[model samples]
Target: MELTANRSTCIGSGQCVFTDPDAFDQDDDGIVLVLRPQPSAGDELARATEAVQICPSRSLVLSEQSA
Candidate 1:
């Protein structure tokens, strides 16, 4: 899967970063930064999914990678 972050709607809650620091981070203004656009399977994917679900502003998105 691929992850994307919507900076416009982000509230800087840092939930995504907290959930998966390996795949997510925050900029100087606290906007979410996608460190790993395509997370590996297994534990990485699980954490990415959890981060998307727990985002307070719903700024994180997980989508199927294109061929």
Candidate 2:
């Protein structure tokens, strides 16, 4: 799976960072940053999905990586 962040829409809630610190982080301005653009299966994928879902600003996108 691929995890992407849209800093423009971030609200700095830190939910994504809180949800999965290994997969996400916040910049100095608290905008969402994707630490792991492509998460591996199992726990990593689960956490990525959770992070995407919990982003209040909908700034995260978890999608199937295109071929």
Candidate 3:
């Protein structure tokens, strides 16, 4: 899976960080930072997707890998 984030619109909620520590983190300004943009492992993919789905600001986005 592929992960995408709108850094400009992040709310610093930390939901993505809490959901997937390996795939997400907080920057100096507390914006949601994408650590792993493409997660392939089972658990990693699940957590990344979960973060995307649960983002209240809808700044996190997920997409299927392109062929």
- When summed lDDT is taken over every stretch of 10 residues in candidate 2, the lowest stretch is 17-26
Report the CA-based lDDT of candidate 3 relative to the real structure: 0.89
Ranking by lDDT: 1, 3, 2
Candidate 1 Cα outliers beyond 4 Å, as residue runs: none
Q: Among these predicted structures, which one has the highest lDDT?
A: 1
Report, for every candidate in turn, its global Cα lDDT versus the true structure. 0.92, 0.87, 0.89
User: Whose TM-score is higher: candidate 1's or candidate 3's?
Assistant: 1
**1 versus 2: better TM-score goes to:** 1
Clash pairs of candidate 3? none
lDDT per residue for candidate 2 within 1-67, as digits (tens), equals 7888888988999988888888788889988889899999999999988888778988899888999
TM-score of 1: 0.95
Candidate 2: give the clashing pairs: none
Worst 10 residues of 3 by lDDT: 41-50
Error of 3 at 16 (Å): 0.4
